[model samples]
Target: MCFGPFKRVCHWGPLVALGIIKAITFSTVTCLSQWWPPQQSASGTLVFVAFSSSAVLTLYFFLQAMFTGPGVLPAGWRPEVEGDTRYLQYQKH
Candidate 1:
């Protein structure tokens, strides 16, 4: 369980798992780079691959969060009662 910006409950397990995976991937890349000759082009390629992979993962997580339904609302929640529906906006559509 996680509390979002507005104190709404959210299932953040997947996000946490993604973060861990990202960290592990980065560490593995760093280790692999250390095994390669620093002056070699392969070393540069490894670095680029590491960064690109991280970037792709970041984008994937961003899209996943953006597309996931709104987080859990409080018990007996109602947008009209909350009175913020008029000001609410979604960038995607």
Candidate 2:
């Protein structure tokens, strides 16, 4: 279903998503500079910091999700304890 983690970056969908992210970040910085002017206003600086931090953190989390999935349970996997299979048996809907 998937390739190696680094190779995953080569896929088109994610590449496009990353490009979108970069574009949005660039546009946000551009807008902040024009209207808020981080250099001239404390509020602007704080807003920039907040937005930038959120963006960076978003990338960080995204990287984690992309590279190493949150967690997975193998298909048909079962607990080791005896009689557990009975608990797992559910009628097909």
Candidate 3:
């Protein structure tokens, strides 16, 4: 039913989601900036707003990787082995 190293699930899903979210955020920010007051335009406020938002998203992914090792692997269907001597022997000391 699945393919490749991670089976059917892969990093592509998250990458696509991030792309959509970033596009939406960028569009919303651009729209809002068009209506900002003249004084605000000269202050670089909109640029800072967009930059910080993107930075936060980038930082969040790094933090997530730190906390969670990686994507979940599909469970293998092999029968459960409990206290098997051969299984225990295979483990590195």
Q: Cα lDDT for residue 28, model 2?
A: 90
- List per-prediction Cα lDDT, in the order shown: 0.64, 0.83, 0.58
TM-scores, all candidates, are 0.38, 0.71, 0.38
- Cα deviation of 39, candidate 3, in Å: 4.3
Q: How many residue-pair clashes does candidate 2 contain?
A: 0
Report the C-alpha lDDT of model 2 over 48-84, residue by residue, as the tens digit. Answer: 9999998898888877878885565677788899677
lDDT of 3 by residue, 1-93 (tens): 545534323467655766776787677667666766435675567565666678577758744654465554354433366545344322245
Runs of candidate 1 with Cα error greater than 4 angstroms are 1-10, 37-39, 43-51, 54-62, 65-93
Model 3 lDDT on a 0 to 1 scale = 0.58
- Of 2 and 3, which scores higher on lDDT? 2
